[model samples]
Target: MTVLTKPWIWSCVAAAVAYALILGLTSGRGAGELAYAALSFGAFAAIVGLGQMLVITLGPGNVDLSVPATMTLAATLALKAMGTDPGTAMLGLVIALFVGFGVGIANYALIYFLRLPPIIATLAASLVYQSLAIWSNRGLRIKPPSGLADFATGRFLGLPNVAWVGLFLAIVVWVVLERSVWGRWLLATGQNMRAARLAGVPVELVRALTYISVAVFSALTGYLLASFSGGAALNMGAEYLLMSIAVVVVGGSSIAGGNSNVPGVWGAALFMFLVVSMLNSYGAGAGVRNVLTGTIIIGIVIAASTRRVRA
Candidate 1:
């Protein structure tokens, strides 16, 4: 496909233009500042969307519903472990990743061994992770390391360091999904699992590793978010679950699987965040904002379904 026909490129351009117009009409004084803020905040959603994209690409009806819980638990654990020591902070980050890895293993076992559907298995896993996060939060005081906080909030070339991290992750994921042998195997598996299996494509292992990779991504996002916010909270990752799925779908990824648009995920993330920002600038309440967001998501899903039918 030509560059201009790529959904990611157009979606990004549309988002940027729409954001500028909204800022000009509503606020009229801080377009640049608001743009920067939107991009910075949207980076978190983009990162999570990337993980969701990976899972969804596994096949139709596959999704990782445990992302929010994994992120929250990782953040809580990291905060408690850091406690003001630099060395301890790194160790804490590692420990949080390990926690997420453990959850991935559980998810794999439930789905692979029990023949459970991915959605139900992940939902059950989410409950476990959420319970653990809540239990960990009891009577705990959180103070994120100053160094980590600084890095998260710091700016380079007018963008936050967190945004840079998101960009780097996007590059990595794009390369893996578009330019590597593993990418071909994953696409083949998603396209036709039976065919892939017959061709010796290790479908089971690929699906299992996809879950683990998503968990790691979630854990990393949690750490970045906690550091950016200077602390952790139970609700920090709550909004991400729907947002990630929405971003992936709106970014032109096939709900049926076998196709992914890496850059489109980034654009869709920006678009969603910009919509929220614009509504807030217009003094819209949370209820109205959510309603609008939901409506947009429904529209996108319908469009995607229609496109698939036509194809």
Candidate 2:
């Protein structure tokens, strides 16, 4: 049976329901606000998950560690460029996209020419990016332009604007992965870069595009997070490193690549964000909370590998 017809998806759904039940039972203090928080975080997870799907599923043997740094940089730049001009926010967003693409190119160049491992290359790039972020502001916090704040803080259909952005991204990625030749090449390259190269698939180009695409998405996510929080901080992206990886891994994508679990991965992202949200709601402290979240992510990684081996 296909993974879609298997128990994993249902398991994710069950986990989500169980999470809701737990939240339901503990309702008393600001439950509504807590619920909104859960939903908002879940949306953010979805956006991060999309980036992961594109990266890992597009290049089976490769994975990126620069997601957090790229995101932080893009967001900070976007907020900085906005600079109190509401009308220029669009231009700022465009710049953020180019920034993301630039990061991707840097990674691709290192991996392709220097033959650096994806993880190592991304790690080095992340350090450099983080350093630049610090150097740019001298460790100062950067706020979104005043006029641009309303979009992040505003609600449509009683949901945060970020949710809308996530929904749009999901739709866009789904279409690209399911319908386009570029998407097909991504999957093909991930499944077997050697075979793809022999088939004249432009394997290097595809891989570079995948990294670039992921970087772009991560940048957007960071921008949203910063806007939501009212400012971008130097350390903001650090915490997201683990959370983003967890979302993708739990969503059913393998670290080794080959198989792509699009829907499952999306569900897993939501499942994880809900887990963190609930844990926080229950007054779990940061240390305990991260431990629990990390444990769950490790469990998922093992389970996913076991499933693949059994298959």
Candidate 3:
């Protein structure tokens, strides 16, 4: 299919148009400010969405339910590691990465060795991570470092640096998916795991690596979010779980795997943030927002699934 005809591309265009319309109708002259805020906040969702994209590309019925828990744990651990020393924040970053790796290992063991379904395995892992997060948060309160917070909230060249980070990550994933042999292997494995194994694709290894990559991305996102918000909370990452999946699905990544739309995920993330921001501006309550968001996601998922069936 031509790029223009790709469902993901069209979904992105539609999202942009919807955002513009919402701004014109609601914000008037303040649209730019709202847009900037949305993009800044949306960067976190976009980053997490990339991770979700990788995992979902592993095939049908695959998802990472541990994302929110991983994010929460990373944020809390980072705050603990960064205590009273801005220069030592690297320690926190490293710790977050390590935690993510450990989580990935656990997930791999559960799915690969225990032979659990991906969803059930990840769901169970998520509970363990959540418990860790809760345990870590107990009697621990630390301020995020000034430098990290500044970097997260600062503007470089009139754009949020976090947004730039998100863009860079997307580019890296795009290159891996489009220009590298590993990308080909990943797609092939997703398309037909048994066939890929027969063809010497190392299916198990690819799946394992994908899980690790997703965990690392989730950890990074958690750090950035904590820095942006100036502190970490037990529920800080709860919202991201659904948002990450929604962006990937809305961006045209196949639920059945074997395909991904990297650029589209970014647009979908921004669109989701805009919708939430607009609703907030209109004073919509949390319940209303949740219902609306859920309805929209369901619609998009149904449409994507239908298209896949038709194809």
Candidate 4:
């Protein structure tokens, strides 16, 4: 019943604090800026973690990808919306969500309907998304739209708007996944599709919908990123796909399926963000960042897998 009773939670907190301290000591960046960076990473990681939750908890075939594409497309759609009237912007969000959903549906159809492997289907879809983003951006950076740029830069009660959005999203997702009947069905389907189908759980539908949900979340994350970054560009979603998976795995979810821990996802995301930000502060290059991040994630996954094996 006590908070400290959870080893996973305590580990995440300790990791985050230690990361910040290390950065502060090594880079002379000051505790204040390091703290702010930690928050920023936490918010970003939350969105990424959500994507991981969707894929892992809702995957139909023990695999999920296309996260990066969905996010990039969503950010592009938001940018396009900014070029339109107020009414259009609203419509654009809807369209963006639809597009994201469509991506998911396509994945499902390819895997179940066409009998393609999940990895193949998702990888193909990811390529399509990457292609679309590259073509649209025309090798240019997504600039912040003048009208909506304020939302990204504006801070409310000391937190950036993106942070607030992340908070709201986390709460909403927590409620939906924990309180809804459909949520039970989702978990059931993820745990055992054949069993769920035998019990008349509409297995394929749930599986497809899971992908759709992930797509929607990815898109939403993209929208937030565009708003926060002042626009979107190519490969914007690439970094997140790996990070999201790492977060989920580190947070204690098996890549294969079953468990869904919302709070753990939050902690893992924060911890990851802190690690990356801390490394950045230490003047680590992107290559170094990738190496360190990947190493850490692999170690976590191995440890988790070992624990599962023992238990």
Q: Give lDDT for model 1.
A: 0.84
TM per candidate comes to 0.92, 0.88, 0.92, 0.85
At residue 163, give the lDDT of candidate 4.
Answer: 71
TM-score of 2: 0.88
The prediction achieving the highest lDDT against the true structure is 3
- List model 4 lDDT by residue over 1-311, tens digit each: 45544424532764677675675566655666555656665777677687668668854455667888888877786566565344344555676687788888887888888888877888888898878877776646556555556766677887777777777888877787789877788788778877878998877777777777777878877776776676677777878877777777777666667667676677777778777766776779999998987787667566556655555
Q: Candidate 2 residues 184-238, lDDT tens each?
A: 8878888888998898898888888888887888888788788778877777778
lDDT of each: 0.84, 0.75, 0.84, 0.71
Instruction: Report clashes for each candidate as comma-separated counts.
Output: 0, 1, 0, 1
Q: Give one digit per residue, the lDDT tens place, for model 3 in 1-311.
A: 55555657645665676577677676566777876886798899999999999999989878899999898888888888788477767888898888888888889889999999989999999998889887876836577888888888998888899999999999999999999989999999889999999999989999999999888899899888888887778888889988899899888888789998898798888878877766676678999998987776677666655665566
Candidate 1 lDDT by residue in tens digits, 127-245 = 98998998987735487888877888889998888889899999999999999988777888888899989999989999998888888888888888988887888888899999889
Which whole-number lDDT from 0 to 100 does residue 91 have in model 2? 78
Candidate 2 residue pairs in backbone clash: 251-265
Ranking of predictions according to lDDT: 3, 1, 2, 4
